[model samples]
Target: MVKVSFSSALAQKEVKKDAESLLPGEKDPEVGVPLRQPSRAWCWCMCLGLALMLSGVVVGGAYLYRYYIVEEGRVFVCGVKYREEDYIIREEEEVQLPSHFQLRKLEESIRILEREQVALINVPVPEFQDSDPADIVHDFHRRLTAYLDLSLNKCYVIPLNTSVVMLPTDLVQLLDNIRMGTYLPQSYLIHEEMVVTEQLQHVEQLGYFIHSLCQGKDTYRLQRRDRILGMQKREALNCHKIRHFESNVVVETLICEP
Candidate 1:
């Protein structure tokens, strides 16, 4: 009304509005919105999780390397000293030590042996008639030789016949004897003995028979002639008790009590 300019009046209204907005009791433009800060708990948890994952990977890698990469490639050569106790009947003798080679090499040797028709047999004592022990042993050797010759074409057979006589008691004595140097060069003797002893126990059961002896019968007695006849029949019927086989030449020991 006092000749004031319109532009000046508009500017004054805008300033008044801005002042009102900044007043203490006025609503702020950003009211009711929460500000987010980085969480310390979440950061710590993520770091711990990553550390645990890294530790597990390291342990698993070590185990794999030890078992597969290192151990599987290693070769162990054992010196087998055959003691008299090693055989149930024969005296002590030393068998040649096996050539030391990696698992792959040994496997290759075995495959070669098979391809060349090698005869590898695990001999178990067959039940014999009422004859001398020496005769039984001799007969076994003869039969084995013939069987092996017939079975293989071009071959090298390792005779483990001495292993047939190994008894549980003999095994205990062997360990002690080897440790005490009853045999010379006690370096790897004990270790070899233990391996062989364990291996022998894994073979088939020993052969034996039960014979019943009866004294003077009074009334119900079968004559000696009849008894002898019956025995012959039984023997003839059970003659096929012995078991044998042939294949690519691998003998796995089966564990059982004697």
Candidate 2:
């Protein structure tokens, strides 16, 4: 730094002499074009160049905004969220797409089921019976879930309007309570008795469960089995061959033989 400063100081003398030689009254100087302010045309040209550059920048920005921003998400869709049915893959967004083959297969099954009119009844009820609407449907849905759990590796809700016909045990229980004696139980509604399709055998089992639960152990027949069933009993009967035509599961009568 000190050496640079000393060199600059020595050069200042020559610079001062050059300045003195360029004064108005100076003579015997090397002739050259005199130093002057920039020409008006040059100034105008510079201003025009800057204006054109700024305009070009604005036009390029407008074109990019229109192409990228305005053209996004131009597809129609429906579902929980208002998203495009056909989504564009984006760097910032993550999406888990459904398997096309699996989805198509499932849809095909549903369509086939839908085409087959509602399942044929298992048995004829002379008159419609009154029961808790919620309990019956929920129990049936739950029964189907348990039945599917073993055979099916994946879980999905099967869409159907399920109506299961069951034997009335509530009335029998009331009668037993009034008479102060244990009543003998009857066998549950089985698939053989109903007009059920090959697809709906588990639903028949569901009917059996409903009827058995309605018995409520008021009869001597049910007491021993329920006591025996103990903690192992479940609302659903998990059958491996539920849809198989060859297998038959007749749920035991809760009541003892009279």
Candidate 3:
């Protein structure tokens, strides 16, 4: 590097020249100049634009929220109306049977006999799902009155339709009369089938007998088909039938998927 010393007179002349060359309001560059400030009108304009964008977002969000609420309300109302109409139609078309309690009392009358060597009362309960294990039970005495479900390891009594199935005493007496030749007993075969339908709610109200039959399962309805034709035809998909001779009557209870 090169170093040179300036005389006092030369340094004073250079400072005077720089002062004379400066404009009235301009600051000297050696001391650093401040940047130009933005106008008040430009700052206000930017703030207004941001506020308008935020307001639009709030209004759009509210509109979407209200739209979804209205749509959901409409769907719920329509579903309720449809269910009401369906209930009315069903009531008119079908004859209501006695309540589950009445049926349970009748089932309780029949005794639960001891298990036989070979289990025969293997029947599926309602709402049979794909994942459920193989549940089989035996109707040992050929009475076809009660069964045990191996899945739950519980015994359930089936209510006999008095209008259809004769009482145990009457059934035994009929067999004796046939043997005595009191009258020519015309024997005919009948087919009875059961299928899983809707879920059975309020199982507690059905009493112990019915509760065991319908417990952990859906409601099953008997589907009566022509004896001759249905016996020959194949059963439906996921359908299982259990046939047993109860002295005088041949009973077949079919359980199927819902």
Which candidate gets the maximum lDDT versus the true structure? 3
Kindly indicate the candidate among 2 and 3 with the higher TM-score: 3
| Per-residue lDDT of candidate 1, residues 149-168 (tens digit) | 11111111122333332322
Q: What's the lDDT for candidate 1?
A: 0.28
User: Model 1, residue 207: what's the lDDT?
Assistant: 14
List the candidates' TM-scores in order: 0.23, 0.19, 0.30
Error of 3 at 218 (Å): 5.7
Q: What is candidate 2's CA lDDT for residue 106? A: 5
Q: In model 3, which residue pairs have backbone atoms overlapping below 3 Å?
A: 121-137, 121-138, 121-139, 122-137, 126-218
| lDDT, residue 91, candidate 3 | 27
lDDT of each candidate versus the true structure: 0.28, 0.28, 0.40
Please rank every candidate by TM-score, starting with the best.
Answer: 3, 1, 2
lDDT order of candidates, top first: 3, 2, 1
Runs in model 2 lying further than 4 Å from the true structure: 1-27, 30-33, 74-258
Candidate 2: 10-residue stretch with minimal lDDT: 104-113
Candidate 3 regions exceeding 4 Å error are: 1-160, 172-189, 212-236
What's the lDDT of the predicted structure labeled candidate 3? 0.40
Best by TM-score: 3
